[model samples]
Target: MTKTLFTGVLSLLIASCSQQDDRICEAVAKAPNTISECVHREGYLLADAEGSIRDVATAVVEKCRNHIIQQLLSKPENGPSLEVYATAIEDNAVEEAIRRVTEARSGNCKKPE
Candidate 1:
């Protein structure tokens, strides 16, 4: 019974995370500039606290970069040619996210623990 309860709780947690990701991604799709804030707020740190700012930034990008791109491409406004723009959009998002993280880190803001 304990195992079953744990599994159920885990499943709910996973679902909630996915839902949160979806909501953030959708917002990103509407406002590309918010990518950095969203990433910083919601992204999981792939680096230890000792890692450099750039390293932590890169890790943040690696976390949700794809999901943002996917959300952008999924928009109906883009239609069929959205795939053609995917590369450019992704490139911009990555750069923006990295830049944001770097700036935040430089401001003495602590990376998530």
Candidate 2:
């Protein structure tokens, strides 16, 4: 019984630690600021077909969409599936994430001075 309890506790600890190690997962698990930073570090800006500059964090977000969905779904509040979340952010989603980071950066990031 003691061995089983110890193993369960150890498993939980390991899982928590592993989640912290994943930047994208951590961001999704944390506040908006962290999410913005994570997006910024993994994304950039690009000119859209409409000749407007946009953040390209959508690709990064998409790349980690599955992980993000899983993490979010782990919480009782976010009960959406991966496909639902993907559809919501499919259009310029990375750009939106990048925009958040850029907004928070306030000219501190790659934005031209």
Candidate 3:
């Protein structure tokens, strides 16, 4: 009984540590200033596409989409079949990224002088 309890506790500890290591979204979400700066840099590279803020935003999100999906999949509590939620997750992630970039550009994602 003691051995079984120790194994369970150890498993939980390992799982929690792994989840923390894989939490890319959590890290990004926590660093608003960093996200703003990254978006600004990416947007500057695409500055030639004037009047297409959405396109620039989409490109930035696409750059990070794979990492986002990988982070989502790493969560032990997520569904077993990522394929089932892939479309919805992609759409939601893109929409949210665009919204955030747009908001930041208006407020904080300024070109550094």
Candidate 4:
């Protein structure tokens, strides 16, 4: 009976974590600019515990950066210059998201012991 209860609890926890991750990803995809809000929402869902927020944020940033790079590269007529690419990256939503993630990781969203 004890083993069954433990198994059930573990299953529920895993399901809850999966749901939270899905919600976070959806929010990021819907509004990449609103990364801070999404991070806060996920933090709340996880009770401010270290719950894959860093990993999710990193993945989001990488995907956004790759998409931007591809878009720039595809525009041969525009002759994408190094300065332009640097500016685009600096002024992008992904940078803001990464900053927020760093702040959150160092601040209130730290891993629980």
Q: Which numbered prediction scores highest in lDDT against the true structure?
A: 1
Clashing pairs in 4: none
TM-score-sorted candidate list, best first: 1, 3, 2, 4
- In candidate 3, residue 24 scores what lDDT? 26
lDDT of 1: 0.54
* lDDT (C-alpha, whole model) for all candidates: 0.54, 0.45, 0.52, 0.48
* Model 2 lDDT, residue 69, Cα: 59
Question: Highest TM-score, which number?
Answer: 1
Report the error of model 4 at residue 63, Å.
3.4
Better of 1 and 2 by TM-score: 1
Give the alpha carbon lDDT tens digit for every residue of 1-113 in model 4: 99999999999977664442422232222332343444333333343344465555555455455455555555556666867765665356445555555544444343222
**Higher-ranked by lDDT: 1 or 4:** 1
Native-structure RMSD, model 4: 11.0
Q: Estimate each model's TM-score.
A: 0.44, 0.32, 0.44, 0.30
lDDT of 3 by residue, 9-78 (tens): 9999877644422222222332223334344444434433455667766787676555555656664555
Candidate 3 deviant stretches above 4 angstroms = 1-51, 75-80, 111-113
Clashes of each: 0, 2, 0, 0
Which pairs clash inside model 2?
A: 57-94, 58-94
Ranking by lDDT: 1, 3, 4, 2
Cα lDDT of model 1 by residue, 8-112, tens digit: 999997776434232222222222345555565433333234576656666676666666766675667736576656666667656665655554433433334
Between candidates 1 and 2, the one scoring higher on lDDT is: 1
For 1-113, candidate 2 gives per-residue lDDT tens digits of 99999999999987764332222222222222333343444443321212223424445575546545554555445656766655554444565665644443333233211
